[model samples]
Target chain A: MSATAVLRVDNLESYYGPIQAIRGVSLEVREGQLVTVLGANGAGKTTLLKTISGVMDPEKGTVKLEGTEIQGNEPDRIVARGMVHVPEGREIFPLLTVAENIAMGAYTRSDKAAINADEEMVYSYFPILKERMTQAAGTLSGGQQQMLAIGRGLMAKPHIMLLDEPSLGLSPLLTEEIFDIIRRLNTEQHVTMMLVEQNAAVALDVATYGYVMELGRIVMADEAATLAASKDVQEFYLGISQDENQRGQRRWKQRKTWR
Target chain B: MDFVQLIVSGLANGCVYGLIALGFVLIYKATEAVNFAQGDFMMIGAFVCLGLTNADFMGLNFWLAVPLAMVIMAALGYLFDWGVLRHMFGQSQVSIVILTIALGFILRFAAGTIWSHEPVSLETPFAGQDLRFGGVVLGIDEIAIIVVTVVLTGSLFVFFSKTKLGVAMQAASQNQLAAYYMGIPVKRIQSLVWALSGAVAAVAGILFASKGAIDPSSGLLGIKAFAAAAIGGFGSLPGALVGGLIIGLVEPLSARFAPDGFAGIARIAPYAILLIVLIFRPGGIFSQTQKKKV
Candidate 1:
């Protein structure tokens, strides 16, 4: 509530053909906070991130980045304004070398010394990238590619980073490693973050605040710790039913999506 | 001596083909659209050079006319991309292909009206000069063509590997959406690629014009260059040049050695090689597949 929101979205809506994908989703990520959006497969989670990042146009909402209205702005312009998106499924340029891919992330900025320093900073976090600096990005393992994606995003020196499904296809151990770095980025570097993920358990751990999205709307919003302890989250999202009375209902509800 | 002469001349011809093929591959690499009018762009360049350098016209120096013509063609290319090709982004490759073919016809007619269909020799400072070696003589135009192609290709290779904008263009060619995420303007980069392609075509046209006679129909040479691009693999830049050289070498050899009964085989030699490559290698020699979408 205090630090002043860096990224603010108000009544944002996006569409896919004739169907409404995301409906009136409004959220705020304050400065120096790691926020996560948890949702199921088709809950408009990706659409929300796309709309906020300017990849998809928002039909009737306003996106303000650092108090600048960026609704009709281009994706490249939004990135120049210091909001970088590590898109879903790690869209790293496969043909480009590891170093070149990272260099492209700083394309908008022309400060030579600062960009070099930022690249070194990226190598510090993901040291494996430094070892294979000239290697093509496609050759990296899945977990390493995920790290490269995050490293590339950091090259922008973004005020806030939008991460989509960082844990999508990683092993639990690998996911833990990625999330640790994500937390470090927010706490140590003071870069505000909004992570969109289906891995509720892992996402809730790193996030300070959480929003649970179902269908095209937010069904629940609270602090991360409170949401993790909630009975609804525990039973449906975490797959932990402590009460014997709710066990059968939990089994029946497991097959049903969040309402 | 005749065989060596044939080789020199074949190589010169190949350089022009390679340059045109380079244009095709450059545009193809960035946009995934086949520019059938690439040859017409070459015609326009030759005409532009002719207009500037002819004694009865602007009468600029040969070197001056070359660069001036290239700039005009580059601007035309940038305009075409921004005004026309930009809207075809989401369209299928066939639609773009057909659109470019129609564009070729329009350019041909426009060039025909403005410059006429008569074949005209471009005046150059070194047109009649030659260098004599142990057993073979090389025309200045032939020497210029080889030197220029090698230098241009080498510089382009360096630019893509070393410069920021060049690497960004490479990234954009590989993945448009991902390039956008990196804050690279995908459309602007695409337009720049077109401009670069047009400039390369201008060089090819000027080199060709200085060497021999050229007319409105000279742009038809893009067909052979297209064949060369296919053999090199549509996505690989260097591959297109190599492909062009192969066609270039094979032509003179075929013309010299073919039996009396098959006197006309040299005319169809490039297409024949293209056929073989297609049957054996579906995507060309350096075939680059599309990036897998998530």
Candidate 2:
């Protein structure tokens, strides 16, 4: 584990009713860094987040947050410890009002004034949520619901945000906006993020560090820039041919979109 | 004038059933469990009031004993949750319904054991008194039932709408797992809901006993209340009241006009309404508020 590691996982093994979803996987998320785990479908990305958030218990191995073991705690206790999971499907309470959904996220907080302030911060980040605050959450469009899911997680004031496929089912423009929001949250708000994404291109574009997960194991871990330029990554994940890689580098230089 | 008086009396009687139906709605909303033992719980509530207010026992004043009876009924509800309902978790809905049916038998037997299966009348301070208005006669006891139901319903509305705990209960009713994630202490809320429902049943039971003669078998009135709940929409609060009113009106009106075989048909008005409503709109009239996502 690195000296600045905020979360440390040692040989974490998780299962779904005797079917092993994750087997002996080890990873570390460092403080103030945006880390992305890129994996194909059924590669245990969702299971890992569920295990870390205490929704599912790992059969073995230690999971420590800030050097303290927090394995086997319930999801609510894990959430109270400031590790909030924005689940894969944007499971916002459909019948609840948008404002009610946001308020519910602050259920564990003791300080009403602090919760109120956080509520302000969340609505400011997603101004559209404020406009339809009292509307039923199910009525929101797919992109808006995703934004609400992320915003609801933000209402918890998490120390480390674990987002599972945050851009799933979103349009190209909305996907870019979601990633840009992630970038701003990482840099401006200084929130440590661990994003699980199948979109390798966009994940590497915004992430400070990247890990390639195949069959529940980390096959590659490197700085984002190095991984993006690697020939193996270009062919297998990034879909950039050797000639196109050169063109992509030139095109990258002409834009500062992520910054 | 006579017709107006009869309607007023029927409305008052309907309020009693409505109160019990409200209990059915409360538990159904929170747990999605239809408690077949609701009428038996009401019976227990009346028995508790009889025991507490009896001159031979606590010798407590009748008015003073009412709240205590409600408290005892609520405690029984909490115990019932802790003892039976909690154990039935993860069981099929049919199994739960059957378990409640079994509980009804147990409650009836227990009440009979304690009170000897005989009739007992709760003598109120203002028993057998009628207020006459324009040659129309209205029993004070009946008027009292209406007043109490209005007050209780009003307070319950405020509780569900304004309080934080109430909002948490409503959230839990919609999604138990989601409520747990919000740190709402879902188990405790479930228990509280049971207690509240039980207390409401007890109120209805006491009101019922004041209006008529009672025996252990009087718990059968729960059938009428259950019908009222179904008529109003199984999970709706105000629907129960309206169902109860419709049921109440149908009975005497039929008894007065037809005065024969039609009495049975009139008594079943709430059930008929329930069937018609379920056929057209399964969620009830207020179903627009909640819709399941595919």
Candidate 3:
């Protein structure tokens, strides 16, 4: 990956009404890199992505996309600037046919020939979407929906894709299948991605770098191999509690913070 | 022959009701806000068309006046959403209902100021023309209503289904946040939906004016359209027309076929159908849209 950052969130602070959800979080994803954010359910991993993608406005932050500050702009404007967010819970257009659902991803593009080629590229990434192209998107199984969600993101030909929990509710096998494609896209398609995942094992396996968040703050940041080797990550996030008896006591200790 | 004539005439009247109901349903489908002023919009549209075509007003040709009136209504509709309704976001649905009801009163008063309370007639190219087919007589106005309604409905279906903007509209209606994530301008699409609804209301108003004399009170006819929308299911396009047809058919048939001294209830037939539908299948006949599972 290049030293130039594709996305940069500096000291971002976001709130849900009065309560802050993402607190002074800073991260950067370099070009052609697959970065993962690891956090528990309430650590605000989703909110961080939401803020960066312009779905939620940040109270104090600068979201720079390719060094252009884009905080507080409308989501569509952010999307037009070449960042596509595949939101959590797979918010695919249900009533629309699967093909139409994919077509919506390319709503901003006007190049008819390039769009058709991109559609083919997306189908190649997820062949099942091609077979179910005419069917209503709602009919797809959960795993396929996740794949479709990612495929929809692929249709944008986005400069950076923010994936919020691609393996959110999928089976382990399906998560592996999706992560395989995610890795393929990063290496082959040169797609820069910042993926929010609680599935740390799979996430760290594919990510070039990872950030571990705790209570809306980044507690750790390191290269993927180093993060994977860290004993604290294995116990807390990776579910690799080797000894069942003292697991709680062992997790009560703090390792380190990024700052 | 008389029965066929009654059916045709009823269908024509239903077309007017159905067109108005379509506006009702379209707005409801996109925003989930019940626009109580839908009829008032029709009232204003008719008056506007009259003002455009009448010798006392703009004195434009009928063909020119119709589209012009529709365009005028569409702009007003866009303004209404941008100015009034946009602020009502996160407010209760009841608040929006009250807002629309107040808008209805204002529209009626404004229309009365422009056109007066007195009834008036509009000059149409096809006025007083009738076609007879094997002893069954049909007014050209009635034929025009049926033909126009069918054609408009077909075009709208194609627009929503085939076009990119139309598909974007469907996406916005289904899930606004998701649509926004996909780069669809949800707010603009919603404002456009309001504009489209206004244009539909204008067509209904013009057809209504073409059929007979009109006054400010003609907007009260929207209650039947509301009934039609409810009967068709609030969000279903085809259901609105079918519901309006039921009301139209029932009105004449109830008046003509009922026992003596019971004709007074003919006017309330639409409401009665609305009541029946509410009591039984509240989802309407063609309630195919389901809330998407996230």
Candidate topping lDDT: 1
DockQ values per model: 0.67, 0.37, 0.73
Model 3 CA lDDT for position B10? 92
Query: Candidate 1 lDDT, tens digit per residue, A55-86?
Result: 88989989999898998788899999999999
- In model 2 chain B, the worst 10-residue window by lDDT is B285-294
Q: Give me the displacement of residue B161 in model 1, in angstroms.
A: 0.8
Q: Is candidate 1 or candidate 3 better by DockQ?
A: 3
Candidate 2 lDDT by residue in tens digits, B80-156? 89888888788998998898889889989998898769888777777799998778788989899989899999999
Rank list by lDDT:
1, 3, 2
For model 1, residues B170-261, the per-residue Cα lDDT tens digits are: 99988888888878999999999999999999889988998998998899999999999999898899889988888888899998999998
lDDT of 2: 0.83
Clashing pairs in 2: B232-B239
Candidate number with the higher DockQ (2 or 3):
3
The 10-residue segment of model 3 chain B with minimum total lDDT is B285-294
Give RMSD to native, each candidate: 1.8, 5.1, 1.9
lDDT of each: 0.90, 0.83, 0.90
DockQ of 1: 0.67
Q: What is the number of residue pairs that collide in model 2? A: 1
